[model samples]
Target chain A: MATTNDYLKGTKSVLPILTGLFPFGLIYGVSAVTSGIPKVQAIAMSFVVFAGAAQISIVNSFSSGISIITAVAIAGLINLRMAMYGASIADSIRSDRLLTRIFSSFLLTDQVYAVSITEKGKNMNTNIFKFYIGAALPIWLTWQAATIIGVFAGKTLPSWLSLEFAVPLTFLALLGPFLVKSHFAVSALTAGIVMVLTRNVPYNAGFFIAVLSGITAGFLIKNRKGDR
Target chain B: MNTSHLWAVIILSGIATFIIRFFFIQIKQAPLSGKVKELFSFIPPAVLSALVFGSVFENGLSSLTPRNPYLWASILAGITAVTSKNVLLTISTGMIFIWGWNYLY
Candidate 1:
C-alpha cells in the first residue's frame, strides 16, 4: 500500500508531458464539435474513449456518414498500440490482483507508457500502477473538460487560432525526441513512403499499412545489424 | 443525431479497443527479442508521421503540386517541428502561415 507521497511523486514526473498534451486536448474538443458531434456527446467521448486518435477517427467517420461498424474498426485499429503499451508495463507491476492490473491497463496511453518506462529506469521499486493512475487520471479529466469547452464554443472559435494544428504539432514534438537513432529515421521514412503510396486505400486503411511497413522496416534493419 | 447508432459505434469501438489492449496484457510474460522491441519502438513515429502528412496534404492521393499555401505552411511547420521540437511554436507558426496565406491568396 503506497502512501499519498508515493502517488504524488509518480504523478509529478508526468506533469510536464500532460502540460504538453493540454492544448491538443483543447483542440480536439473544438474539432469534435465542429465535426458535427453534439457538445455533450463530444465531451463524453473524450472521457469514454480517452484516446485522441480514436476519438478523432470516430467523430470523422460519423460526421461523414460512415457505417458504425467501420468507424469502430478504424478507431480500434488506430489504438491497437495501447495493447503494446500495456504489455510493456505489465512487468513493472508485481500485483496479483486482477482488478488492479485491469484498472492500470485501462489507463495505458502512449504518454503514460513513455513516462512510466522512463521513470522506471530511475526508480525500480516504485509502485508503477499507482504512479500510472496518478499521472493518467489528471490527463483524462483534463481531456474531458477541454472537450466540453470546445463543444460549447464550437465554430464560434476562431479559425485563425486553429486548434487542429495542435494535434499534429504535439506528435511532431513527441517524435523529435525519439528520432535520435538512425533506425528510427529509416522506419519513419519507410512508413511515410508507404502511407503516401497507399493514401487512396478506402476506409483509412492506409494507417495500418503505414504501421506495418514501419514495423517491418525497423525489424529488418535491426536484424541485419545484429547479423553483421 | 441517431442515439442508437451512436451508442452502437461507441460500444463496438470500446470493445475493439479493449480486445487490442487485452492482447498485450495476455502476452506480458513473453520476452520480446531485441528486434521485436526495436520494431515496436518505430510504430509511434511511423504512425504519427503518416497521420500528420495525411492531415496537411489535400488531394494527396491525386496531386503533388503545391496548389494550396496551407500545405506549404504545414511543410514549414514540419520543418519547425523537426528543428525546434516545440509544439507551441510549430503550431502557431503553421496556423499563422495558413491564415496569412488564406488572407493573401
Candidate 2:
C-alpha cells in the first residue's frame, strides 16, 4: 500500500534525474528564444508539447523554413519512442484508472520514465500510479519554469559558456547507470555507433535507425548468451 | 512563425504524443513475447546512447577527431557518472571541463 510518505519518496527519488534535467530545460528555453520563435509560442511550446527533443526539433524546423505540417510530423516521429516506453511500463501501471492513465501519459518523458521504472524495481510495494504522479508533477513544473527563465536569460548568457553541452551531459548520467550488464553495454555502444554512422540521415531518421538496430543487437546478444 | 501555425504545430504534435503514450496502456490483453521482452529491456540504454551520440557528435562522423571539446568532456562525464552515479557531479564536471577547454583554446 502507498502512504503519503511513499508519494513523497517518489518525489525524492526523482530529484537526481531532475537535477540533470534542469540544465536541459534551460538550454531548451534558450534554444527556443535564439531560434527566433516568439516568446509566447516558445513558452507555450513547453506547456503544450512538453518534450525537450521534439521541441528543439520544432524550433529547428521553424528556423530552417520547414513547413508547419512537416514540423509537427517530425515532432510526432521523435516522440514515437514514447510508445515503446508506454508498452514497457504498461504492466506497472495497469491498475491505474482511465483518467489517471490519460493524465499521467502526458507526463511520460524520458527522464520521468527512467526514474519511475527504477523506483518500481526498488520498491514494488508502493502504489506505482500515485508515485508516478508525485514524481511527474515536480518535473513538469520545473521544466515549465526553467523554459521561462531561459527565455529571459537566453540573450545575456555568453556563447562560450556552452550550456548546450548540458543536454548530452545529462544523457550521459542516465546512460551510465544502464551499463550494469554486458548486454546493456553492448546495446549502448552499438546504438551510439549506429547513430554516428547515420548522422547524415535527414529528419532524425538516424535516431530511429540507431534505436532499432541497437535493440536488435542487444536482443540477439542476450539470446545468444542464453543458448550458450 | 505565425501564431496560427505555431499553435497548430504545438497542438497537433501534442495530440500525437499523447496518443502514442496512451496506446499501449489501453491495450493490456497481449503479453509481450520473449523476444519482445528482450528488445524492450534494451530500449533505455539504446535510446539514451543514440541521443547522447547525436548531441556529442553534433558534426556527425567528423566529431571523432581531437578538436571537439564535447567529445572529451563527454568521455570524462561518462566515467564520472558510471563511477559515482551522481547526476550533479557528472553535469558539473562535464560543464567545468568544457568551460575550461573553451577558455584555454
Candidate 3:
C-alpha cells in the first residue's frame, strides 16, 4: 500500500483547505470563551467532540438552564451528516484494519469528506485508507492546536475578517467544478431552494429534507436522461 | 450547568457523534455496486448545497438581498470559484468582500 506515500499525498492535497479552517478554529475557541463557557469544557469539547460545526453550534446554544440531553441532541442532530460520509467512504476504507477504519471514521469532517471524494473522483490508485488517514490527521491537529491558541488568547477578534464566510466559500470552491455538469447543477439548485424554504423547520431537519430533495432531483434527472 | 453536567454533555455528545461517523463504516462491504455508487455521487452536491445555502440564508430569506454581505460575498465567491477554480482565491475573495462591505457601513 505504500502507506507512507499515500498518507503524505493525502496530507498535501488538504493543506490548502486549512487556510480557511485555522480561522474557524480560532473563532470557535474565542467564541466559546466569550460565551462564558467554562474553559475546561471549551477545551474538552474541542478535544473530544472534534466536530467543529457541532462544537461551535452547541457552544453557541448552551446556557446554564440547558439540559445535558438537549445539548447532546443538538450535537447529534448537527452531526447527523457524518453518517452519510461514513457510508460513502466505508467501501473504500473497508480493506484496512478494523481499528484503522474506526479511528478514521471518527476524524471525518466536511473538509475531509470533500477531500476524500475529490481524490476518489480522480480515480487515484492510492490506498484509500491511508489517504483518508493522511487527509484527516492534519485537520485534527490543526483544529486542536488553533482552538487551544484561540481559547487561551481569549481576545475578541476583529469582526472584519469575516472568516466564517470562508466556510461556505471553501465549499463553493470544492463544489465549483462539479457545477459544470448539468445534473449536478440542477440538483444543487434544487437543494438550495429547498434549504431556503425549510429554514424555519423544527430541529434543523431542514438539512435532511434539502439533502433528500437534491439527491432525488439529481438521481431522477440522470435516469431520465439515460432513458433517452 | 455545573462542570460535571458540562462534562456529561461534552463526553456524551462526543460519543454520540463518533457512533454516527462509525456506524456505516463499521458495517460496510467493499466494491459497491453501480446503482449504490451512483447514488453516492450525488451526495456532495446535495450536502454542499444544503450546507452552503444553510449558511447563506442563516439570517433568513429577508436577508437574502445584497445588503447581507454574506449573501453578496458568497455570490461573488461563487463567481470566483467558477472562473478561477482556485480554492484559495475563492475564499480570499469571499472573506475580503464581506470585510469590505462591513467596513463601509
- Give TM per candidate: 0.83, 0.75, 0.68
Candidate 3: CAPRI quality band:
medium
Ten contiguous residues with the weakest lDDT in model 2 chain A: A1-10
For model 2 the local lDDT of residue A202 reads: 77
Give lDDT tens digits, candidate 3, residues B17-82: 999888888884544577776776787777667767877887557767856777888888888877
RMSD each, Å = 3.4, 4.2, 5.3
Per-residue lDDT tens digits of candidate 1, residues A1-228?
A: 334465677678878877767777776787776666677777667656778777776765666566677678667766866766766777775357777666666677877788778878887667776777777787776677767776777779766555555555555555665556677767777776777777777866776788688878876786778742
Q: Please give the range of 10 consecutive residues that has the lowest summed lDDT in model 3 chain A.
A: A57-66
Off by over 4 Å in 2: A1-24, A34-37, A52-100, A109-135, A201-205, B1-9, B28-30
On TM-score, the candidate that comes out on top is 1
lDDT string for model 2 (A117-219, tens) is 8888888787777677788889998899989998888877787877666666766887788787788889999999999999888766777799888888887
The interface root-mean-square deviations, each candidate in sequence, come to 3.3, 3.9, 4.9
- By lDDT, the candidates rank as 2, 3, 1
Question: Where in model 3 is the C-alpha error above 4 Å?
Answer: A1-42, A51-101, A107-139, A160-174, A202-205, B1-13, B31-33, B85-88
lDDT of 3 by residue, A1-228 (tens): 334588888899999988878877876787677666777788889978898767865664464235677668756766776777787888787755778776887898988988888888885687877888898999999998888887887645565565445556666776777688888888888888898889887766676788889989999999999942
For residue A43, what is the lDDT in candidate 1? 69
Candidate 3 global CA lDDT score: 0.77
